[model samples]
Target: MQALAGFLWWAAVFLSPVVREATLGNLDPVAVAVFDIPLFVVASAVAAFGVKAAALVSAGWTGAVAVALAIYATVTTEAGWGVLGMGAATAGSLIALCLVLLGRVPTAWIIRGPFAFRPAIPRPTAASHVASTFGQIVLFWGFFLAAIPFAVAFLEGRWAVVLLFPSFAAPVGVAVLILASALGISAAVAMSTLGNGTPLPSAMPNHLVIAGPYRWIRNPMAAAGILQGAAVGVILQSWLVVAYAVVGSLVWNYVVRPLEEADLEERFGEEFRQYRDAVRCWVPRGSKTLRSQKP
Candidate 1:
């Protein structure tokens, strides 16, 4: 159910100003942006309180928002109502299907965020860990980043012109992208080889990875990602990309990290807590080295 909400929210964001423009031609993008990922994020936050009534209210609001969008479409555009109806139906179906699937799965196996215990599931094999990390990378780099240029074009009602790569100050952008890629990839590799797992919570680093770039900062991968995003923003000459990176980082700091720390404490116990005490989540502390264990 949560995944469905997330997907619907994402789909709304992906379609974005195109949907806005086509449906409500002169509507402010800012208003629509409010209902974008931020809305779903807020809903998720409310749901996280573990109050069923509150969660249900949030879900109800989400549905109401969908219907309001449908009505807005009906009033404004010729074909928008049809498009909105289809989108609503699709979102509803996906939510229903997910609820059914979740019903069959143990609550223990259901993933909530960056960190959580999964008692019903077996620990990942080394290969599975590597694969999951690579998959996430592909989604982050290949899919999300690749989709942005096209998404922007769609927002501008220029679907005939789909651009997949960043292009403004190409030379500098390429250098920056390459450097960030090196950093992120190296960090991921260290997580796999030293930690014996992936950066993802699902295939979490089994060992406290204090090697390689991790020796520099606790979250080299996230830093690299943000840097890469900044590079892309520079390359494309788009503040939007830069803003996305900033928001992503903020979400990690405020939302993802604390939960992740809690889960690490639950899993690795005092070992992780001690590591957290020693290392900064973003900034690297004063440099010091010790012989590392490869567990």
Candidate 2:
């Protein structure tokens, strides 16, 4: 909800003609389009700080820029293509850039040690670490460096039709990609939910998540990641997404999980071991299960 509101509000600012006429000055549509790309990128990047405020602020700002570009394209003569193209570029870059910054920002800036300003509760466990981590890494790289390819593909109408199919055959290839990406994202989210935000350092106080999706899957975040990946694949219609989903899932299962277990074992010792036995690792062993049993 906050995200939606922020997006709409900022979007208005971006689309305002006050910016366009003042800058472009009756230039050809193509020239204006070319010019606006850099402007949007710079504007969005600069306005993007607020890691402690709320996740939506970043998203809202980016969305607004995209909306602005779209609105500009529609309003201007012979600039429809340019408008949408720039809008897409703006949206992709902003999201990617903001996320990368958020992921890297020191915990101190966002939280005054305890009082979580943005996502509120400092570093409270997100519902899904698998999903969260994977999503974060992807956004960090995908949005930052790889945005150009994505923009080109999207503008070409490569994966858009997946949004409306069976009505099919228009571009079935893209649809498959979207589905695969969604699955991967869902899986990652589900897996992360297993431990609710990676059991942060004891020195850093935060909420201990034990309910909602956390209760069921032990790692709903990971599951969500699988879903996210599949969704992206479908949305992008890219084989590379599928490969990523598969490889990433495997790495999480074989590598990341084991390492995490080792750390937990050392930290919580027998208590964590007991929890591990009862709580079926990746998938839920069912309800009425205990967090720690004597064995």
Candidate 3:
């Protein structure tokens, strides 16, 4: 039911401007933009209460902004220039907003004009502790640095090279997929955190996660990374990026995450083992759920 509402809300965002244009025949994009902002503000506030809600809100806001921008462009100026600006902003914003919703993916917020840290809580189980802390430091921090070029290439200029990837498509498709995957990942992270972390959603990461996406697959977050990364690669068409995706995914799975998981197991002991047994490391092989495990 929640997913359905989210999809409908998202669909409305993309379809609204078109509907307005079709019905009204002509309208100002600025007016559309003005109307759209409130929708996002309301959605964001509502999403604050829960993870699925947050994912839906993020998608709603993103679709609203993009479509509004498109309408604004079509009505005010030539579609080409307006599209370029909107496209750039949407791509950048998708990554930013999506990352923010994935609670496990760390990000900072500005409070009083200064950046305030809001990191993910460390896992208390042996499963989470194995990743070399240094590896995480490098990958996440590396993401920060990588974000610059990604934004620059995606928005500021057309790096002719981006035309090659399979997943890369037209601007509209790319935007939609990015937003969708972000919400999906946000949902996965929410499940992981709630199931494995503290009982209170906002409390902290308290244990290793091996349910939901973890049941079907080991690293849903990494899958999201690949999706978003591919979106960027498609947008930029940089061979380096394509290569980066291949190398990065392998390393994250084989080299980095296992360490984190091992540490988690060591920390939590038999409790972690019971969770692991009930849940597949990365494959959801059976109908059973870990809901009946020993606490």
Candidate 4:
């Protein structure tokens, strides 16, 4: 996938001249051919050889190029097709960068050091957990749902893009939001009351929480959060916001979940392993079956 992303990025740059000519009228393509073409080709080639250093460099360079093109399209270009082209290029570059980094870097390196998951010593009280959960809700809803979406909308407006939801989508989004909120609240309550902790890693529950929503799914909070984010995007009808929510979920799943689970296994040993093996991470299973196999 990393190699494919690199090639796709190279291909996008290689065809920049034609894309620009078609969308923005006649433009000098010499600069791209002379500079970008050779640079990307060599970077992609070296990265394909499984060279970690080369992959890192390629990822950085491609990301920088993507940002530059996005800025140019948003600020300098008036053509819609040109903006779309730039968007595609930016997506390609970002995909390439993510793939390269994930493929090359060790999981331990990514999750350890400053990024390590360290649970709080001396479990927090019920009052403290309640306060922490409330704070988290405010931060997540205010920044991620409201502020970031507003920013994305502002940027999209610069390209003369208008996003709107269908009448039905608003109701559906509301339904999803309500359900997700309920699930998240339930999970938080379980963590606090039963597990004796907050949702934050720094104040994680000391005990394994297999009650309430955990009886069905391994990560009810995460699922609810991701669902809430997507519901907000649906309500707002912003593709960028939806993509942001999806990307955030992917990051949490691939990067954070493993470390979290590792910590759980280390602490709870066979108890956690049995629960994990029985329950699905995102999906809920039949209640009877889950209850029957309760670890």
Leading candidate by TM-score? 4
Clashing pairs in 4: none
- lDDT tens string, model 2, 1-295? 2233334433443586643343232544356335333344334444454443333444454466456554544354323343443445545555445565565423243234543322222334554444445656577447622474365444434212123334343356456445545544544444345334432222211223334444555445555555455445445654445445666677667655665456556656786665566666556757556642110
Name the 10 consecutive residues with the lowest summed lDDT in model 2: 198-207
Instruction: Assess candidate 4 and give its lDDT.
Output: 0.69
**Which lDDT tens digits does candidate 3 get at residues 57-174?**
5565656656665555444442323344334444444544555566543322211132221224656552342333324434653573267437545432332223354553547446
Give the TM-score of each candidate: 0.56, 0.35, 0.39, 0.78
> Candidate 4: which stretches are off by over 4 Å?
1-18, 21-27, 50-57, 77-103, 109-115, 160-165, 287-295
Alpha carbon lDDT of residue 234, candidate 4? 82
- Write the residue-wise lDDT of candidate 4 on 1-295 in tens digits: 4445435644554477654443343334556546555455466667666566665665566556556655754675434444555455445544555566675335455655545666545544666766777788788778887898878766666654556767798789889999998999888888776676778776777778888899898999999988888888887777667777899899889978988998999989999998998888998777444443222
- On a 0 to 1 TM-score scale, where does candidate 3 land against the true structure? 0.39
Q: Which residue ranges in model 3 land beyond 4 Å of their true spot?
A: 1-168, 171-180, 183-204, 210-212, 281-283, 292-295
Off by over 4 Å in 2: 1-209, 291-295
Model 2 Cα RMSD, 1 decimal: 14.6
Candidate structures ordered by lDDT, highest first: 4, 1, 3, 2
lDDT tens digits by residue: candidate 1, 89-208 = 445433433444353323333346544543212344556666767887998787556677434323322212113544546678779899999999988888876676777666677677
Worst window of 10 by summed lDDT in candidate 4: 286-295
Q: In model 1, which residue pairs have backbone atoms overlapping below 3 Å?
A: none
